[model samples]
Target: VRATQNAKSKMAEVMPDVPKKLDDWKAAADTLDQGGQIVSLYHQLAIFTRPSEATTAEENAKVIWRGRGFELNNDTYMHRQALMACLPMTLSEKLHNDMRRMRRVSRKTVANAIHLAPVIGEWRGTATPTLILAGRRGQLMTLDLYDNDQGNFNGAIIGTPGSGKSVWMNEIAWSYRATNAQVRLLDLGRSFEKLCSKANGQFIEFGPHSPINVNPFTVVDDIDRDMAMLTPVIAKMASLSAPLEEVQYKAINAGILRVWRAHGKDMTITALRDLFKTGTLEDLEIHNDVRIKDLAIMLEPYTRNGQYARFFDGRANIDFSNDFMVIENEELKRAPDLHAVVNMILLYQITQDMYLSRERGDHRKKLLMIDELMQQLGEIGADDPVKARVVEEAARRARKYGGSLITATQAADDYYSSKQMETAFQFADWVFLLRQKKESLELLDRSGRIVMDDAKKRLLTSLRTEPGVYSEIYIYSPMGEGIARLILDPHTLLLFSNRHEDNQAIDQRRARGLSIDQAIDEVLRERSGKPS
Candidate 1:
């Protein structure tokens, strides 16, 4: 009786609303007694009482069954399965104390028996839905992104270079494409070529010599939103500071809007730059205070005959009608400034396209997968309101448009090294931590998606990478968290492998004028000892 009062006092002290929760549970019980429908109290209790790590499996099993108020006699042996099965529900008087000892405790939705049964052994519930092999324990575990409730369909994968990050990205992209979802990738390392080809995807190479040029002014579907998107780039370019920077930003925004309006379909970066050079912008409220000449001088480099004149100056040479599009940025690796701008433009374009597609009543799934996302988003401050809004708006694209944005990086430092990186990762609903550097683990721990206790840390460090097979990965999401080895079949392995010879062979096949699908079939025949 004393212990019960003490427990109640502790609960009251820790949770001021304890009485409310208990009353709600009591009301639920009363309803059940009166043959009313079962109710959810939104309160949950999970008990983790493990035996000593050094103990044998048999010893651990024995200890779990008979310890702490459990009475299992010699004649009535408790099967391990039965004991484990009852673990979720058996109410022990001593367990309350253990629950109080834990921290960061919050109320979890208390699901009734029928609704909770399938969630016990697997992540899915009731009917077997479309299952994509996300990872495997003893057998393949599947997850359906379309389910919406299990997760938000957003994902972030971070790991060291050789830790199979690309492999997993390839698998997930291909899996979605196989399910008939429109998939796209912003390829950083010239990877995903073979896989892109296999899916009959358009592989676009953006380089100085490449015919592709993206003019953000004309390309942007919505001028107001695009003006906001261009603000960061303009701010970064002018190297503006304080009052002058603010004045220039407004002038340049008004100038672009005016040029885009006047030129309409003919508007390009070159024309926009020319307008800033000589055009008057009396329409803008701040036109009298700002110097249009300074803004034009800042924008000259992106205009005709300037250093970046070749990019975003001419007409857009590429088409977005294809279901699968892979934009390879291998050539722009050394040009960080141009790379960042182009990335923003592409992201905006994709977002616009997705919104337009949805507006046209096409609700098919779309994805924007970015490799080396940290390099693309640049160093955004955690508190910088403008950049913060940009990241938040990017996250909202998932709901507004029926598409998901996924990013993969080599280190958590790349995404958490700055405030901007911090905000970017925070918006993600799913995280996959592959084999990472010891230093990176600290950042991951701070991510708050997965607990970084000694046991979990040990589990993360124990992950191994093997050839021709998937590496071990720790996946965490709002639904749950676990360690599983990423699984892939032989055909997918061939398509997504990073082997040099295989890629060269695929290139050779493409050179022979074979369609990507035909090339894939031929390569499969060569691998199988069958006639092509």
Candidate 2:
């Protein structure tokens, strides 16, 4: 009984101060209600629970009851009865503490789920709905679709062959198709067959037999920056062997400019080659000299005379009148004109289209994915006039005209010599790095101006693994904010997000050219190993 009395004495001391605090709160609440300020009371209540002085039971009861009434009150009545009712002070205190605890628990649960799960689902508008997958060597792979805002996306997959790169690429393609995006793939490795099958008749295969009839030179939507850099080199080569007494190099440039102005709208490698085959020295009013021979040699690399023709001859059955061109050849030739002219034709076409689209106020987004861009650029030195101009335009103005260029290569060192590549790297909104060779990583680090702390270095180092399982992604935004991190597991399969059984059935049906119902039956029959 004596111990209980002492505890009661302590409560009395604490309880008196509570009422005083409540008195002040009551006055404040009353003023807020009369002045039409009660709408903000809930926010104040949330703030008040944090280490403030206690209030009287009567005063506290008013605040608590009013808070409760505020919640239950309809939109119509909430303004009128903002401070009339009183609540039990003890109950209100208990409720607030419980809510705080619940919120903390909920946050922790979501964090854990995100850490363990894969990003799945198609992007709606500009949002990237991704699934993070665990990759080898403590890396995380993420499949993201960045809407270029034209009509297409800048799509990429980072993983080694067995690490699920192919699976992820196919899944992304499938998701894009679901949104009604037309995908034109130049799959040199033939890794997209399963994905192509899923597109039904939309899928077109381009091999040696059913080739694309369009010339790479003619379909200029956007000039590749790398190609632009090669132009001056071609010009220089054209000047090298010209006899001193022949038509000046400036005249040749002027004539070439005239050709571009007159025929640039319909210019293509096929067209240019035709021009060279049928056009004579009289067309440019120049003498036939060793300089002409040099010009021919410089343009030899880009001409259709060699193994390069196989690329033009191997396109699928799709119409290239409006679509982007895809060349499958990887060989590097010595002729500067061949390289320069091919690139020029493409660049001119792209820029011309962009100009027309801009004039018409067309906002359709487009994407140009150039694989092994460095290989093409390396053939043209910095001195090439036409190549230089092409690269400059691609890096600078393509984005304004609703086009985005995505270039991928194995190493950053390959682009070191070309100013065009350097320019693209500087302006590229995003830079993605997968498991890179040490030399390649160093080059990228230096070129991108990346500064790493101990934690970041650790992350980058961890990304380098055997058979290259880990990928270090460096995302640079034109908005000025950048993110660099190590994904512990790379989500390589976008297909895992789909209903796997449904997708498999669709694939089987597509291969057999069956209707949806028939496809379902065929898949079941195949699974059961029975004839349908």
Candidate 3:
């Protein structure tokens, strides 16, 4: 009130205008008179630059400030004062006196002053950050996918095709490997092949004419546990238009037990199907009914002499010996009917391996990354309740056994498409949302999940991706939601590149007796025509 009475100036002085400053002061004085709190605000910035690039740095600063409708002062004389003000716990008497005399300040009521400082928008991730990223304003924001008090590292990555989600998530899975975490990828389109190779990981491609195959019938534990685990995969194979009936499930269960009794630890779906063909469940009082015979025809495609036999019925050939394994099913993904059932089988088989790994060694942290997850989740869940439970349990059991379940989808609704899918999504404490079409955004709005508000929804629609540069994404977790840019360096880009030409280049160099790193470097050098 005293400053407002005596220090009223008529001219528009310095930076923030004089008459407007007095108006602000009058408001503060009124608040003071009414016994409300009045507060003062001050700000300082110190930009460090090379002597050669000082002018360029100053212009960049002007561009940033001008975007916010503020003019830059370029006060060369106050450099020392600026440095002094910015250094924490180093207040100088001379700088304080100079600030008092200069009137380079703003005063407002407490409510207004609170917004001026002490409220940094950036989220500082956990102490040991798994992924480092940059906020929109170039502030440093990071992600602590593991080693945080949040209790679970499960998360999702959602974006439209060509939105750079593959590269972004490949980088994340790569980063987790740095922490010695075991990583496995269930992928479509072979998005993880390059990185898997780079990490000396197992890359098993499931398709016709492929050397690898997935057999879910192997006995990992007791017969009952293996039976319970195979229940979902078997249900997915037999049921086409509807969920399996109780009688069919019991018949399938009886057939599986007989196969185990016959083959012991070495069993396959072909063996189970053969057992079902014969009327031989007399011991358990579970006779082969007509429904069981109908199931045999449905299960024929997965049998030895059936069409989809090679891909579905064999002993598992891959190993968890390495910390990383990418099980890519591009061919199966193309076959919509087969993709849903195989996905459920793979999810359980991987977790069973996880259980075996726990028994063999220390319970080190592991990561299960499922790419192209949107379509299969809801369809499989609604079609087969048993498979849906297994799918959701894969994510839930990940946290229980010191691991994380990370999935990527095309949109938000796909994550919440079914009750089981929503349950799986609820386990995701961290999520990445990239660019979306306007129509996709509208669907997300109507999906009835309170994911983002109007402003954030607008932000999501405006996200962008550059082919060789950075891609912008909205990162969400229990901590907070903020935008981040995933900018990969040239080498890392080559490691994550799935483009056929780039991959062919890498493969050509590798065929010439080059290591993964050496081949990638050769590719980078060839692209740039400069040795790097």
Candidate 4:
């Protein structure tokens, strides 16, 4: 209190004629508050004083504060508040400017941060992951997005025949070249050449004349892993055809197991065949004659020349000379058994290999992209035991082994009828629905309980304006992220910025090495009705 009184006494001595009017003192105080510091406060007060009234009094007051060594600490809230109170209008302007500047800086910082962050990983632990292409407009597009690493993915891409399905697949294939992912394409239509070229990956064609034609009777070692899948089914079928006696059925099953075990620990058809050719019924411990007969018949197509003879013979005669060979022979035409056997075997082998790869801690992700998957489903009727087992096993192992099986078709209903398809769908952690036909969409929507009405309405509205380019994509991932919708635009085919740049580079290369000027001239000339 003594210091405060002394300070006030000195201030009064320096400003003997200081403003006594309340209004003048309030105005000066307002200016001092905004200025913040004692020096700035005194300067602002002087500026507020009228020129006609710029007497020694105001000058003396400023000198007094300066000489007294008065200071305002900006860091203190109370001091700042006092400063602001002294300069209300100036404080308001300064606060407004400061907020605007801060907002601008924040926006720029956020944009830079997003740009620096790499895209999210789509397939967990996979360096080379299978990319999901969403149909945007008329082109197949992919977003620079990834689902959480929960061992599942959902993707939907829709387009007509020429709408770039193959192109999109090619792009995805190429994207994984640098990673440890392997792609096994079951392309009925050989459209992955460009993808193969860009990724520098090998393409094995599995059409007719391929040495890997399906055969259940052929020795497993020489057999295409795909064709070997039918052995168990054939054994089962043979048992079903026998008498209804339980003893006979059990015996048949035992004989089949003997054959399976005879293949040794590896469990292949070749071992089974060797066992039948060398081992006696006593060796197999088969007490029932009916079981032996059934087993012999089951082996006949593979070992003897009969109705199913060609199926086994074609596979046996295939030149094991090449690691990969095409089996294009008339025998394949008459041998439906061979076709079924081969496809099943291939599916089995691929799945097993994938599982083994996982066991070894190999980080290479595998993708089985099946176009016209419905056709394969159709071949294996719902009642077919072999189809059911293979599909179930494949679906189950696919997730466990860090592999994915993508099935694409024109309509979901055609494929959804099979119990196997349903099982596979349930196991599939992700589902993608592209621009489907109205009926097809309704069927899927109803089955999945998606809001079909709103989707249909929006789709119709978009289509009327954009024609074939407009479509919708719905994705569901296993991590409970649930469904997400996106509109497809043909203009942006590839979603990632890097992928887009790569496509642009490819386009430029395909332009026949024309200079920019020449290309522009060609376009202009073409538009002007001139021949280039």
Candidate 5:
């Protein structure tokens, strides 16, 4: 009010026509007094030239500024104070002293003062970051794959072959284990053999020769929930061509109820298959159902005297009692017909383990890492969607049960190409993208669904890997994002190596009465040309 009165007095005395200017001044002063949205803008202008061409550089700089409609100001008078004011991390005392002599805010502040600079996108991850990673600036940082505030724990890892994807996964699994979390890795490639050995974890090679009593028929306290989960596995076994109708699922459920009523704890695929011999689908109220009978016949291979009887007919013999268990099935690729079927069996069994209660009632933090997520997803058929739904539900609710899912694939086509895989892996809150094909990267750019800033896009496109030394990866995470290097020492690199030669060397030493650790040390000694 005092300023308004003084402005009126001045205007009436000698500047009657300048009242409009006074009004503008009054509005700005009022905004300042009211503490509105006034932000300080900082801009950095870099001028590079040879010492001898300094004069010419100044003239060129002035011309460039003028061309951009910016008036040039010679800072020779207080250059040090002006430059220091623009620099971050400077002391506030020095900043206040430097800025006190600077020009006041004007209409030109927003019009010309804000230009992009080398800003810091530093993210100090979660309070307890599980993994240690180095940022683009070589600053040590931490990474937490799961944060409860985000309410997500699922992760996705994608990369090209030999791009250190295995090493990256080894780091994550190792990091999680360091926190005492229970880890189950479904690795078909045997990539984590050495890491599993080093961790003293079970590296069970699952195959036709190795028998695992994975009974997907075991009852839980909640029979309805158990049926909801078990029905899909049976439906997939009987029908894999297309999606089964609701009636077919109901018939399968009804049949399970009858079998469980009679078999009790002896419920095996063989028993279930045998139930249809004397019993009709009508006994279970599923009349006129040739599909249910056909389903039983289709499961004959899993019954007694059937081809898969030895593997599927037994009770629970496999133990995931250990904290870290790696179930490697290298023979999966050799059997093309049972690829989808086998994947479904292994995944559902693991899901059961995740949901089951222990005798000690200790709920260890459970984590399932699927190394070939896309390939597993690829096994899913168009009409046969039970596999996809199974995976989706498992991942969607894993976080609620003190568990998480981690998936890795070679390309986007590994998951995106299959609708089944897409739905299953889409909830990934943390993603690692190593060097990939341009086409795959395009799909990764949210397929144009979510807009990516140009800076992030450039960083992603610039990703490159120097295998064995370091792998450059862009982390798209719910916590934060940055390009980091997964650099391991020689020991860790050997332990997580997926190299065939390394495996052969380890095997050769083991055949000569050496333990896995002894074999690794011997191999490393041989490579270093040191005597034992």
Candidate 6:
């Protein structure tokens, strides 16, 4: 305080403008209260002066110090008779003091300190072509797929049940649909019906008796690559508990090659099965131990006279031309025995389409959202090479093509428990961690997907489990990793709503022959009329 007063006095003597600056500060202090006096503080100095013929800058500084009644010592203490500077400890002090370090501040202050703009991770200045509104901070956040030049835009949405994982994904699909991006959902829970209907997308439902043609043998152009892609899928479909023997793999390969050669555009799973059933196994050069008969017997159910033969006997019923498409497996959800095979086939088909779209130079951005991925992952072994290859291939295609994948499940441990699932997680550039179980939280804390400090981990661990519009999440991406609260727009919220009353109202309005927009308006009106 005394040093500051001395400096102010010295400034008053040397400069005429010092008095007016002091007066302005005094006026500001007076406006606050009677006890509010501005105390100017100074420390750490390097003296500089305009050159004068009368004295050097060093001598002038010494004169100013002496005039302020500061004492100068002898040569023993004062190394020079020139200007001296002091780097006071206070001037270099850090803001994180013991008393305030542990306290919490307002979100605004935290946002400012971290430069957390009220925008998405990819928002620089101009709007991005493929990003969608993820959630809100101070404003809406747009999630960019092609970020960091990685050319891969894979993501994972992990949380416990009722944590709004499905809702967030629905919002993403809606946003992309708004921008004319090709959006597809490999939906397990049948949660995308309303959203698909709203978007006028192809809603292809598959069931035990539903005659939906999904021919896996339709992949024929690049036989080797297509055969390689279907290997895991066929293994999964056959409910192969263990990895296929080398000869068994080769047998399946030979059968597929023959089927493609014979059928060409008329390729079907029935024909593929017929090729194996010709009883010409030894002629195909397969090893004695690897029975083509065994594979053909397992695949008999998907043949012409079998239970699922109706679905694979004809050409593919669903096309990928729609902007939004949902391939829902409602029956398989109840039949856990079929999820592995069915999902594998479905995903492999999508993979083929992704490659085809890129090959044909389709510039439209694509998204493949797989909901309840854990169900499918649960059926496959942890270290299954076939599943691993499928995952690796998906990640690779995401890079080659401009498509992004968003896979959601109940827990992070579900992915971590399996090598195939974990590979997919590692390949994902963006990770959205919603309200998680304590066990999943521990796994994620130790995982490489997101590096969180103690404070961040604590915040994530203590997140409220209640689900709503503001579905709290901590997103880890290339731009930065931090907590975000996502709130959907009213129309999107209505289109993909999981609320019981909202669904009832929508159904009622639709039964009255109202259009989707009119149904949404009616629902919104009814909701607004209700008391808060």
- Give one digit per residue, the lDDT tens place, for model 1 in 334-435: 766676667767776777778888888888888888888866654333334444555556657765687887888898887766555566677677788889
- Residues 221-332, model 6: lDDT tens digits: 5877666677777776565467766666777777777777778768876776766665465545554342666777778887789877777777766677777899887667
The TM-score that candidate 5 achieves is 0.79
Could you arrange the candidates by TM-score from highest to lowest? 5, 3, 6, 1, 4, 2
**lDDT tens digits by residue: candidate 4, 296-374:** 5555655435444333444433332221121222233344454445555556656666765666777665666655554
TM-score of each: 0.71, 0.49, 0.77, 0.52, 0.79, 0.72
The lDDT per prediction is: 0.68, 0.44, 0.75, 0.46, 0.72, 0.68
Error of 3 at 35 (Å): 10
lDDT tens per residue, model 5, 1-532: 6546756685556866456666766666666677644345444454557899988998888898898687766666766765665566663665664464564223522222333333566655566678887876786777776564665888888888988888899999998998888888988788887788778899887566777655676534455666656777777766666666676677678778787877765788887776555436765575546666666787787777776676667675668678898987667666543556666666766766777744346586678998887555435465336766777777865766667888898986676766567765577777788888877877767764224777666667788888667888887766677788888887777778888998899889889988877888888899999998
* Model 3: pairs clashing at backbone N, Cα or C within 3 Å: none
lDDT string for model 3 (1-532, tens) is 5445434543334434555556777776778898889655566656788999988898998898798676778666777767777788766666666776788665567877776564576655556677888877778766767754655778888888788888888988899898788899988887888888788888887656776666776535766765656776787788744777787788787777777778865787788777777645675565656667777877998888987877667676666688899887776656666787777777777777777778788687788998877555435445345755776688766776677888888877676666556666677888788887887677756764436688767688789988898889887776667788888899998788778898889889889999989998888887789956
> Which of candidates 2 and 4 is the stronger one according to lDDT?
4
Comparing candidate 3 with candidate 6, which one achieves the higher TM-score? 3
**Root-mean-square deviation per candidate:** 10.0, 14.8, 6.2, 18.4, 6.5, 15.9
244 Cα displacement, candidate 5 (Å): 3.8
| Cα misplacement distance, residue 332 of candidate 4 (Å) | 6.9
lDDT top scorer: 3
Report the Cα lDDT for residue 64, model 2. Answer: 62
**Cα lDDT for residue 237, candidate 6:** 59
For candidate 5, what's the RMSD? 6.5
TM-score computed on alpha carbons, candidate 3? 0.77
Model 6 is weakest, by summed lDDT over 10 consecutive residues, at 104-113
Off by over 4 Å in 3: 1-36, 41-107, 118-121, 226-228, 278-288, 311-314, 375-384, 417-423, 442-451, 511-513
lDDT of the structure predicted as candidate 3: 0.75
Candidate 2 lDDT over 62-168, as tens digits, reads: 67657646332222443322222123243354554554554411222233345433345321222343434343333443434453333323332233334333343
